[model samples]
Target: MKQVKIAGQVVPAIGIGTWHMGDRPAQRETEIAAIQAGISAGARVIDTAEMYGSGRAETLVGAALQPFSRQQLFLISKVLPENASRQRMEASLDASLQRLQTDYLDLYLYHWRGDVPLAETVAELQRLQTTGKIRAWGVSNFDVADLRELWQLPGGDQAAANEDLYHLGSRGLDYAVLPWQAEHDLPLIAYSPIAQGDAWGQQLTTNDTVKQIALTHQATVYQVLLAWVIRQPQVLAIPQTSSVAHMEQNLAAGDLILSPKELAALDQQYPRPTHKERLDII
Candidate 1:
């Protein structure tokens, strides 16, 4: 497994996302199995959110990780945007800790850009750090401007990461966010690195070079897509998978390397759209 360090903490380049694992007994079992399989296969980072089925996901993660030592995992959870106020932030994080069955989270993120003042939220995160409840802190869904605001806050130097959607189809970060992250020594955690399955089938079928590359490596389209994202020096990818086979396949992405010519061909074939448009196809 490839690893990236942020704020002096190390995590796997590809981690398991547990958003869809809540609300059913059978699904919960699958979630636990997938997590166990991921860890056994060398995954260290596990991402969850308080809003995922109203804390059900956190509970599942807590129960699943109980057997493992806290130090062995880089657990991360996000506080909902509505609860961004200092008081609400305190309560939300405490509840998340309780649900996760852990005393401290390796990283805690602000789930969205809510009405609360940025300074207030950053200060509260700093306070959580002082109390040892959170080891590192950062934000999610925050654009470049929002990141600048957070960085200007007191104690914001401890902010470790910025979570966002970045893929072959969505290159929003490449234009601005990526440069900022690299300049500041902040690592960008890429979610939906496979474009939520949009990079398969027709997209790959129409491109002969991508097909030939996959054939040469004996890899699937998903594996090739994930490898492309992680190949970037300052990027880390977290692709969600419930099946053991898929989990293994995703983890193997770090091992596959695309030649510069192949990479350029892919970039040319699937040129990133200039404007920021949220396409449902992904």
Candidate 2:
């Protein structure tokens, strides 16, 4: 299986993403089952956020994790940008931990940049690490400039990872953000890694090259997309799904490797940005 290092621990590159999960009471048990199935399939990272359905996702994750050992999982949750301050950050993390039924998070992320000063948020996150409430802290939806500005802060360089929207169809990070991150030894947590469509409404699954590659590997287009996302070192892909079969398939993608020829073909079809492009966020 492909692996990525984060917070000094190695874990599977493919992880479970809980975005709109746990919002429907009707799908609660199956949602929990899907999570557990993913874990059983050897996915160690569970990415959730306090802001996801106002903590509903974290609650579901907590229940699903009851059957597993805590040390076997790497739990990540995000704090709202509004609460990323000295006064409320700790409280927000506490609530997140409560919902997750854990004493500490493997990683805590600032969901996005907000009105709070970056330095203040970084300092609070650094302080929270000492408090044992969080092991490491990072940012999401950050571009190259944002990362450079963050590294200028006192504790910003200590950020273990950054989560962003990345897929074969969205290669803007290829222009600058990826190089900067690779140089800094920072891992990227790619959300929406198997995106269905580009901004122009072009579907990747319909592309001739993508379809041919899927046939070549006898893998689904989604798996091909995921394989492309984690092709680079220090990158992880978290594709959200509510079905047990799909979760299993997503996890299985970690073992799929694309040839240089296949990769180049996909790149040609979805071509990397020639110039700096605005960071894409969901």
Candidate 3:
């Protein structure tokens, strides 16, 4: 697996996203096995949130991680927008930590901008970092303007990454958001890098160029799509799966380096943005 430098830490280029993991009791065992498969395949980063199944995903992660050394994983969890206030954020982190069965998180994030001020949130995150509660902190669904505004805050530069919707069809971030993060050496963590598993049904998978690349590499269209997202050095993609087979496919995709010709063909099929557009979020 490939690794990237983000927030002064080296981590896997692709992580596991546990969006709907612990919601169903019957599927719990399968989901846990899938995560364990990802870890066994060299995926060190695991992203979850308090909002995900209302912390049920965190609980699943805690149980799945029991077999591995806590120090070897980079655990990330996000606080909901309603809990952005200092006191509420603290409580949320504490609750997440308890559910995750960990002493500290590798990275904690604000789910999205809310009524709470960025400065206040950043201040609280810094305090948590200072107290060894979290290694680093970041924001999600922030646009270029939001990033600019955050940069002007008292301790906003401490933000480690900005996670948003990024896939073959959703390239709005390339216009400005991605460039901004790259300039600051901030990692652009892409959630739903495969478009919530809809990429296979979308035109991206059916395009002739995509088919050609898949054929040339002896890979599935979904794997090609996943590869395209993590092709860049500044980007890290988290694609969720409930099956160990898909987990293995995703990890393999991280290593499929696309050629310039293949990349150009895909670019022609899905052109990059020439002007700024509103960043897309799930």
User: Model 1: per-residue lDDT, tens digit, 1-282?
Assistant: 567897587777888887667768778777788787888888888889998889998999898898777898999999987897888888899999999999999889987788888888888988888899999898887777777877887877678898888877676677677777788888887887877676444354335777787898999888888888888775778888778888888888878888888888888887755654442212
> Sorted by lDDT, highest first, which candidate order results?
2, 3, 1
What lDDT does candidate 3 reach at residue 124?
Answer: 92
Query: Per-residue lDDT of 130-242 in model 2, one digit per residue for the tens?
Result: 99989899999999999999999998999999999999878999999999999999999999887833444668878889999989899988888899999999999999999
Model 1 lDDT-worst window of ten: 273-282
Off by over 4 Å in 1: 199-208, 272-282
Q: After superposition, how far is residue 278 of candidate 2 from its true place, in Å?
A: 0.7
Worst 10 residues of 2 by lDDT: 194-203
Ranked by TM-score, top first: 2, 3, 1
Worst 10 residues of 3 by lDDT: 197-206
Which RMSD values do the candidates have, in order? 2.5, 1.2, 1.2
50 Cα displacement, candidate 2 (Å) = 1.0
Model 3: per-residue Cα lDDT at residue 14:
91
